[model samples]
Target: MKRKTIIVLVAAVAVALTLVAFYANSGIQSPKQEEKFRIAKVVRRDLGASVQATGIVKAMVGAEVKVGARTPGKVVNLPINVGDRVEQGQVIATIEQDDLIARVRLQEAILAEVKAEHSRLAKDFERDKQLHETKSISVQRYDLTEALHEIARARVLKAQAELDVAKAQLSYATVVAPIKGTVASVNTVQGETVTTGLTAPTFIKIIDLDRLEVLAYVDENDVGNVKVGQEASFTVAAHPSTDFKGRITSIYPSATIQDNVVYYLTSVSVDNREGKLMPDMTANVSIFLDRRKGVLTVPNQTVQREGSKKYVYVLHNETSEKRYVSTGWKDSSYTEILDGLKDGETVTIGDPGRK
Candidate 1:
């Protein structure tokens, strides 16, 4: 019985040792399981040095025109509404012409009567001159006939002027488009009374959508980077995924202030042959100052600047080392590396201090 107890005690001791060895192995971590290092590789990419700005799309100068009435009358006919396409010389609106027509008829009748009287006086004056030459009439009577003819001729001319004035007034009642464009706004409706006083009443506003342009307000600090003929791209809220391309056509010489910040207005000429772009749409623009193809670049966050010197941490074989680099132009998220870094080199970031 004692021999059996000794065998059982040895088995119990072996089991305890096995449990302790298993726990010891599980509690310890290998060197590979220690703090891990995050790394990124130097990449070759096409980088664009650009200035970002927010601007509004507008119609180019002379692309928009306001159509107005020149005479005061009730709007009798408005054939076009907003968004209607119009051609040059197309009748857009017409005012009440009954009064103007009657005035024109009255002036015509006055002109006709004056012309008849002048013709009769001219004939009588010639006959009286013959009688005076033949001593058949007195000189004063001949002179009186000549004076009457002159007075009648002047009245005829005056009446003709009045008739021309009346005709011009009648023509003013009709409003025609000055250019070919789309009607953007209609300020008057049929039967609305419009007056032509100091200022002509606007009947419709037209815009040439084919000549749409983007007006980008660049910050004053960045205005110097923008120049004419530089390539740019923009995205509108209506077409967020679609990018429209243009070039800087002009830059306003004057500066505009908004909330104490100065901005320069830049005009970008966009191609709207497809007619997808519209006026007054907000455009997020990027003007490319420079573009480099297949250049080595690094994440901006990986670079640390001390004075004029810039450097990044490079990782190799489980070790982190400081590498001073020379940088070129940089965009918002990346920096262009001019030198001191090779392609495929691992850039270490977010690691503890390595001395």
Candidate 2:
């Protein structure tokens, strides 16, 4: 019984010793594991600050045009349709020009008759003047002949003016595109008569797809940071993987309210040379504010603030050392370190006070 009691005592002492050794090893390994995973090295990289906003693709000023008929006439021929590419001065529609041509011909005939009458009266006036000089005609007769010649001249002038007007009306019968663009809509069809009222009746609507812009509704809080000539990038739902580039061209001063949130309209110039972008498409835009190149940066979570001062816990010989730093621009993932940090140094990524 004495031997058994001594053995039990020895086993209890060994188990307690083993447990203390295991706990001591675990405590020593904890810091090493934390340092391995929760630490980052300071490095030099390019950092940029940007503002995000939703936008819509739109046509620039004068990029969209509505072609209308200037004269009232029946649509005789409609040569263009929607999605058709039209050049400037190309005939898009033709009106019934038969009546117009007839009017022009009638004016021409009236002008010819007046010219002939004027020539005959000039001869009579010359003969009368010769008679008057020779005393073979009275002064009253000479004045009468002269008056007839002047009347004929005035009649000829009036007739010529009528002919010019008729010609202009004839030209208006043919509707031509004033700009080079794609036809968006055709409002009138063949056999439909268009009447010109206070405003010309719209016959077609055309849009210049190449001259597209983005109307980004930037939040009022971020409007101050945006300026003209700033570079921007955006993505459309149609082309999710493709990033379109542009520049800030303008900012509207008036604030637009939507659901109680005030926003300012910002115009961004788009390069749609590839022809992938379309008008009215929703866009996700990012306006780049400031950019820094080859600057020392640390992970954003590694920096901690105390009132007006900022500091980081840098790893020095396997121990965390508190170091305050002056920061420059901050991006989504990193912060630019302007002072109190060195290249190739490791810093804690989270609060060092937490185990």
Candidate 3:
């Protein structure tokens, strides 16, 4: 009987510990605590809609050129280096021209001898023609002399043409800058052999830095909204905070395809008077589409699209109410409210107490 009494007291102590643990877990929250929400009041403000795209800075068309050698020769002189400024008609490089000069002199001598022979043949032809008219010589002999005179005249013409060609080939030994620009690259150096055949070897590259432009590849959908003369602003990675302004100058007709998606190349004329931007630098561009003034606006996150319909949450007297809203122009951050919402009206932005 004493053992049974001891067992009953231990079972009562275990039951009391179980009841205390259950009450400790349930006492954290009370039924009177109210649910909280994040709310924002609608306001009127000016909003600008913009299309974003990435592009590379480039020199204008015809402003950049790859200078090449016109004839095969050993490079004897390279007067310019990378980043050197050159003007039109300036000799940037020269090839070994000793052989070319000798060829020119040889052709000149040949042309002179041919011209002297032609002069003598012409006088003989005149005398032979007079003798034939007076019956002083045979008709066959006069015909022979006439043929010899014509052959001499042809030789003179051929020699003159050869001389001109030789002079032209000699001129090719000197490479000149075709346009006024800065030398962006030097592909060849002194003593390098350049062989010109089907394609001339490139010697240098000159580009006009003053005429800088940006080629922005806008997506196919957003390209329709972009037009010539539209104002655009861009920032490069080197100067992220500084905004450069430009205007749309052209839109290429061809579409560039990548991964089955199409993009149109648009050209923007950038003003680089300060000379800070460099070629091949990437630019993040924003093309302004339109600006709406004094429009009722709300945070873009507040509105949610349900298929073709859009709706938002409205806070009325501490109760969350779902209401449909008609929207107009929208930007990256805010959306224009056309109807179903007024200025200074409270709207629920997000669910509270949820992370």
Worst 10-residue lDDT window, candidate 2 = 28-37
At residue 8, candidate 3 shows an lDDT of 98
For candidate 3, the 10 contiguous residues with the lowest summed lDDT are 28-37
Model 1: per-residue Cα lDDT over 215-273, one tens digit each = 99987656877899999999999999998999999999999887667889999989988
Q: Which whole-number lDDT from 0 to 100 does residue 255 have in model 3?
A: 95
lDDT computed for candidate 1:
0.86
Instruction: lDDT winner between 1 and 2, please give it.
Output: 2
**Tens digits of lDDT, candidate 3, 1-355:** 9999999999999998877776578764332322322567799999997767889999998989988777788999998989898999999999999999999999999989988998998999999999999999999999999999999999998998999988988998998999998899998889998878667667799998889999998877568878999999999999898899999999999999865667899998999878788899999888888888999988888887665467888887767788899887667778788899989988876643235
Model number with the top lDDT: 2
List candidate 2 segments past 4 Å from native: 1-47, 122-147, 292-355
RMSD per prediction, one decimal? Answer: 10.2, 10.1, 10.4
Candidate 2 lDDT, 1-355, residue by residue in tens: 9999999999999998987788688675455665576889999998886777899999999999987777889999999989999998999999999989999999999999999999999999999999999999999999999999999999999999999999988998998988888999999999999988667667798888999999999876568889999999999999999999999999999998886778899999999988899899999998888887999999888888765468999888767889999876666578888899999998997756566
The Cα local distance difference test for each model comes to 0.86, 0.89, 0.86
**Which regions in candidate 3 have their CA more than 4 angstroms from the true location?**
1-46, 293-355
lDDT of 2 at 101: 98
Give me candidate 2's TM-score against the actual structure.
0.65
Question: RMSD (Cα, Å) of candidate 1?
Answer: 10.2
Best by TM-score: 3
